[model samples]
Target: MDLPAPLQWTEHVLFSLLLAVVVRSYVLYGLTGVLKDLVKFLRLLPGVDTLIQFILAREVQTFMNKVSATPVDSEPVKKAVEIPEKGCSAEELLQDMAELKALETVTEDGKVFAYVYTMEDEHAKTLRKAFDMFNDPTGYDGNDKPSARENVVNQFAHTFLHENALSPMVFPALRKMETEVISMVATMLNGDSRCSGSLTTGGTESILMAVKCYRDRARELMPHITEPEIVAPITIHPAFEKAAEYFNLTVCHAPLKPDFTVDLAAFEKLIGKNTVMLAASAPQYPYGIVDPIEDVGRLATKHNLPFHVDGCFGGFMLPWVEKLGYPVPPFDFRVQGVTSVSADVHKYGFGLKGSSVVVYKSSEIRRHQIFAYSSWPGGLFGSPGFSGTRPGANIAASWAALRSLGEDGYMQKAEQLMKTTLAMEEGVDSIQGLSIVGKPAMTAFAIMSTENSGIDILALADAMEARDWHMERQQLPNTLHCTIMPHHIGREMVFINDLTESADEVRGKASLSSKGTAGMYGMVAKIPDRAVVDEFILQFFDKAYKL
Candidate 1:
């Protein structure tokens, strides 16, 4: 950008002004084009009509509130609950908190089997401390707030600036850490020099990004494809279906064999011209059985499709399990057609929650996952994935977890988990009616009632719950899914005894009549129109959010 030495001051001024104008006009044009596309896209969204109706209703309500100020004689509505007038002292507050916390399903006894994962109590303390350290400072750009900038004492340790259109003035150390995290995950997945990726909030976000990448890539290659489709196994995590719903893509579910592995022939039949990507689970959550990733990878290569292996539950443990002489199929970048792989550090990596990595075969495909805009009045904007203000403490803690528990430590954990899983399998087998489902490739497995036995698995699950043993029930095979973790290692005897008792108690009581939760699950499964099930599930979630 050097200027000519012979140029006069007047000519230089004119040249600078002209350059500024050209740059401004170019940015404006790009921005305008993006805005137009955004408007068009928004119009197609299902929520848009609802949004417009809401705006109109809000306007009318506001107008009414202003003009019709006459008060009614009805008694004023009372609050459902009242807030305290004053804050309690620390000890008192904590004591009160403990009272509420005591109501939680899982406690020191560790009866619960799902949702929560814990290592040593010391590890829990360390993660909690890490979270508290950065709980006050945000990862937003602090350049505009000098006071906040002044409080940023440990740039490398505390805050990480927003990744989207990351400010040049922000701390560079955090950025470096993020890059290293991606690189570490990529290496673990057998990625090469060209592999690139981003750290997402969780496995769901990672899957969403992958879906978006393939959808956009397909759009670029085949503009005529208005309705892109994703071919995935029915056992694949529901996140794929959620992503499809959000992005207006269709998901074709392939059936699974008796072993819970996806049927390759049926999968091939589902593939069509509109198929943008192929997805399968690496040790699927339902039965903990690894899909035929190598076979699916070959199919992807033949169809020239991007293959995504969701290892969110097993990514961190499968490698070590393979190293420990267990048979693990090639499910990562080592598989020729695996365009992306998602691994959750939170699950088996023993990292804090809200940490997962989504890696691509190369930066080329990753570019499609990123969102960028050039025409904002403030400045150009770009974000790697679904969020703008993600928590950085999770990233820091995730890194710390990895650093604290090196290869040997993870292998030790895997060994313990695997041993516990095998023991649990034996324990289940010992029960006359219950047996482990499929060949569990990892720490997770499911127990189901044998056909020869008259026991009902769901009834047995309800009996187990009655005995204060929490077990996650599955629908497809009517099994109780269990994930063995570090906490469950020494409690094997307790688990076995309780399970044996529960099974004995429920033996020959019912004929799989589907009572309680099982009844709901059975009804949903047998429904002809899945939309009714969807609505019921949606209502269930709505109830969960209620106070």
Candidate 2:
């Protein structure tokens, strides 16, 4: 059948070209469809426009503000300029800020379930007053001498500002406040006299500091090991992963059980020679189901490893949740092997956003978190974690919040929230195709769909959004997240009613169009290769920065 050899070769080449063309055409067509769908979906997202505006039009700070201004707020500069110029008047600045505020995504009065943690109006006013009073104290500075105008600033600074605590004699008042804050938190978490910790910027910093301490501890214990690993449940906060990335430690994530808590056996197995620390969230974020921390703690004790309990989301609430007669498990320092614990005063603690406490069982281990260097020209520099300047105002605010809330205040809030959570859970379960995601341990929970339900969970989320309920959409079995705050106390019926109506609307309309956010999420979930998803997110981040 071979005619001339050259002619046969040419025929083979032509067939190969034809096949390439056909594949290229098919790929192009598929890609075009995906692009269109993504575009449509992004446009339909509720806050995309507002988010873009917020990022672009927000006030930009200048270096002058950093070095000048004792309180920084008295003469605020709107933006950094390429060249020096006259600044806008106070009236002009106020008008401009109003414009930016106007761009905020307007939601139904009580429908927001994320980001803005609203307090009672009176409580919020109290925070505002506290913030205003000490808004500009420098934690990094001692300010031994002051001008007449700076006298008040120094008083507040002396009361709360001591990032390094160079000498207890120098700033005894500041040192005392910090000690009491840690002691109170440690006592709440079941730590005895051995417990010591630092007040950090927030949960992220607290976590970062904890990871660093553990990493350094691992280094001292096993100097020959080149790599250190942190083992945590898949549901642990991203901040832990951020710590791993920042500290050059590897993270081994243990998968979850059917109940959404860490698979204890599997988690224990993930621990290896390189494993330096273990962490588990108390009432993990997505489902709000607490891990078997006591079991995990036992493993830590067996392995002679440091364990950290992340109660950032629920730390302030769980103790109260247990007090309120819920079946709460042992998650705090009461667990035998827990060496460190992080709790944010901002979340359920109802403190300002930038405050959290990370406590260690002893100063011996806590010293690993301190950064000290004497060789540099800047005299014996010693700081904890990674900040040169801590925001003293946040510390002051957190102290105020804790003192304001007291034990009775927190329990009152927890009781109110738990009731609302139960109502929401009950309402979700009553829906034809919907169900609550786990035996949620605290006020946070998620809603998912039944296997036989024809309704798409994502589409249901979209429908709820249409009703002005900005529920947080989540994946790994797609669901909507809800964190019941004080403001959300009375809105359970509204949420349930809206959710029920939305489920009904989306039940049979899987192919109907309002599936923008859900559709994108579903498509992303199907892609087996995570690199493609990473690329998509990178592009999304790029677009976010574009004006």
Q: Tell me each candidate's TM-score.
A: 0.72, 0.71
Which stretches in model 2 have alpha-carbon errors above 4 Å?
1-172
Q: Determine the C-alpha RMSD for candidate 1 after optimal superposition of all C-alphas.
A: 18.4
Clashing pairs in 1: none
List model 1 lDDT by residue over 1-547, tens digit each: 7557666676788667656655665577776655665555556668996897778767756654453313222322232111122322334433432442233232235653332345446776686566556443322121223222213222312332212213211323334446666777887788866778888889999999999999999988888889899999999999998999999999999998877778899999999989999999998999899999999999999999999999999999998899888888778888888899999987887655678989999888998999989879966677888986555556654554454445666677788788888888898899898888888798999888899687878877787788888879888668889988766877798999999888887787775457876566677778999788889889999999999
How many steric overlaps are in each model, in order? 0, 0
List candidate 1 stretches off by more than 4 Å. 1-169, 511-514
Query: In model 2, where is the ten-residue run with the lowest total lDDT?
Result: 79-88
lDDT of 2: 0.73
